[model samples]
Target: MRSNCLPFRADSAAATAEFVRPQRYALRASHSIARCSGLIAAVMLAGCMSAPPSIDAPTTRASTAAIDLPLADPSAGVDMSLPAQRPESLPSNSALARDFMELSFSLESGRAIPQFSRFEGPITVSLGAGAPASAPRELARLVSRLRGEAGVPISVGASAQNHIQIDFVPRKQMSREVPNAACFVVPNVSGWDDYRAARRTARGDWTQVKQRVSATVFIPAEATPQEVRDCLHEETSQALGPLNDLYRLPNSVWNDDNFHTVLTRYDMIQLRATYAAELHSGMSAPEVQAKLPAVFARLNPAGGAVRGLRDDPTPRAYVSAVNRAIGPGNTGARRAAAMSAINLAAAQGWNDTRAAFGWFALGRLSVQNDPETALNAFAKAGNIYRATPGAGIQSAHVDMQLAAFALSAGRAQDAIALVNRAMTPALSGENAALMATLYFIRAEAYDTLGNPAQAQQARVDSAQWARYGFGSDAAVRARAAEVAALARAGRG
Candidate 1:
């Protein structure tokens, strides 16, 4: 989920308290909230599950850099041990059993969500086929005792039959146009034969064998897609493995296993800043924003208390200090700040609004001679806005950046599409100015596309918008010159 600002509501001053910064709004690295800087590169969002920024075409490089660093040793492999015990224990009290007894698993078809189950529980007892006759009673009693210790009312439930159902639902960050591949079953993993059969019986047709489920998570503003997936895989597996290690967990619940396995593969992924640090042995300003989505995906931290991991406050403090240092500087401090925000998102629990703010802020740092970074940041912002709800204004701003970024990236078709999306007749004042910029971008995109006729028309449209939008002689004259150039080119 792209975290961006919610509309300021008259009814919820208290609710919006956490986001009350000195500035009414702050642009992080995202287009949804920042001014377009033509030269800055994009960075990833700093949240869990976010995609990395995609880079424009890389500039041609010589065969070797002036100096190269030594390579690190290969990573040691993970211990793929299967646990002997199940994560969820059975309830002990028969009385408590009824409370959780109704628990069952269901899978969504044609979506990444392999399955999810909710049951009433101080403890819920789900018996495997091998469960002994006394399993339910023992489970209920065990749960009641646990609840009593915690000073909570005891409720428990159990099911004796080994029944499992698979369901599929939408994945997060799913494109509105096309549905990504979903897992009804994965390539290898077991025990849900009955579940698959049941579906065929119910639907009266054979379906795909399996679906591999991915955690539909929001990416931070400064990571990449690969990085986001890796981070999510690690956190999810680490969080859930005590009860269900992928190695030993029954095939009935294999979606969760596959999900975790996928994430483990991404644990080493890094954002541009971090990648640069690793590669250069020093921090450097990111050269582009398009590299963020993948990195952010891998390192986004889950907020709240995780069940088993030891807490580390160092990363938390480091990111915070970095943000403070960047609040005013125009140099390395700003770069550090942007990197810190991404790290913070990975350490802290940031919602869409916070993520959007961070991304917008990051974008601002790229405004100078780094328009590539700015364009990338703007694209990231637009993507965030698309994920965030109740952020029309922010989304509109993001569209403006997307248009500009596309132009800068040499993606003329995309630029025109972004311009079209950003233009809304109802917008006024500052928004109108943005719309005019969209026209300028579209004209630029069309020119790049070698569509001289459309480019000329778009230039005329841009000139009209420039007069209305900027109200500056320089703007009019610059656009007029562009229009004249288009005319001359057509004459030739």
Candidate 2:
């Protein structure tokens, strides 16, 4: 649920000023399935308006008189050659401070936004309908991670007074769950575009007493395992607090650049700082700033500095190219645009990571029509990513794509092999959707090979992995039917 902050297109200061309230904020993150080019257009058009001339402007006679009067230069007291004055020192490292400010405040709406209201006691979280089968385990794992890193009493279990509910639903269900509220002014924040809405119950004078959070996260039924994991890490973390997205943050899931998909050490520090006992639910920026130093000191007594602030060097052209290719509109034109941009990027020698994404996009677009070419493209991407540190996860994603293509080509045995290769323990633990889909595919493969016993077992495994509320039985049956039909047609 990340979005880029595009400039508001207003004809007058008054119009822009009037936009302060009721402004929606979106996270700018990778939307692997949903297309957002039209969202960009909508934001531009919706914010633009014609404005009349100001009533306080001088009349013609007054302007003439003012022109006739002698006036001093506007820059008279300022020395243009001298260096500008440096502002007050930040509370943390320079990059962290800058990113913290951006994440803590809505520059467009002039709001001193705070994190989600905190609980005084242990936090109990529950999973709702549409949650993945692996939700319970993964959420328990995340709860442990948060408890260890932020020293919060957060746990996942069923309770009468659960503080938070996380729902992992399909894209269609998500659209209904996450209404396009007027508060969401920005568009195309994330693919699947999940959202979190929190309510704070407070006593007199805005003193918060209780908090409840309802978060809806979308996992595309067909999304790859890695994409599912990224969505889980980000949407779930954001639900706890730190709702804002800052592109400037180099190594955090809170950044929209999609550079670092998982939560980083820096992110943990921020969470620790936010949930520090000294800070309250409704503290002002200055108050929080006054306390951050002590919080950081206590958390990092060894002076472990915040790291990974270097911005992604991926060119905009490459990003746009990949987006257009994957987007769901104007297929011919968008693919052409993507190819053109990829060519230009290659000519100029772009980063390997960006190139890998570009090739991945091309592979995605080619899978249905040209399986061989798509496999080659995915293999190239996998090879390129394999050389990078902590990028085995990305390479596994490529393998998942390859497996999907293999399944589409009716090569059930090959698809099963690829799926097995991609289903690493880390990935399986993090993504219930991926585990469900893997089992579903395995079921289909077994059915194709006339192994009904194994196929039924696989179906049970799929449902188990998908949990109870995510339409596991129906989705698995539908996918199996589709694959069977494809195999019968011999279209691959």
Winning candidate number (TM-score): 2
| Cα lDDT of model 1 by residue, 312-405, tens digit | 1223344354344333345457666766765565556644434554455565455544544544555565565556543444555555544444
Error of 1 at 63 (Å): 38
The list of candidate 1 runs beyond 4 A from truth reads 1-328, 367-379, 425-430, 476-492
lDDT of each: 0.32, 0.45
Steric overlap count per candidate: 116, 12
Q: How far is candidate 2 from the true structure (C-alpha RMSD, Å)?
A: 23.1
**How many clashes would you count in candidate 2?**
12
If scored against the real structure, what TM-score would every candidate get? 0.32, 0.50
Model 2 regions lying over 4 Å from their true place? 2-145, 153-236, 239-270, 273-309, 313-325, 340-355, 370-373, 388-393, 408-413, 425-429, 443-457, 467-472, 486-492
Model 2: per-residue Cα lDDT over 280-358, one tens digit each: 6656666666665566667666543544333333345554565456444664665576576558657767545555655
Instruction: Please report, as a residue range, the 10-residue window in candidate 2 with the lowest summed lDDT.
Output: 5-14
Alpha carbon lDDT at 12, candidate 2:
6
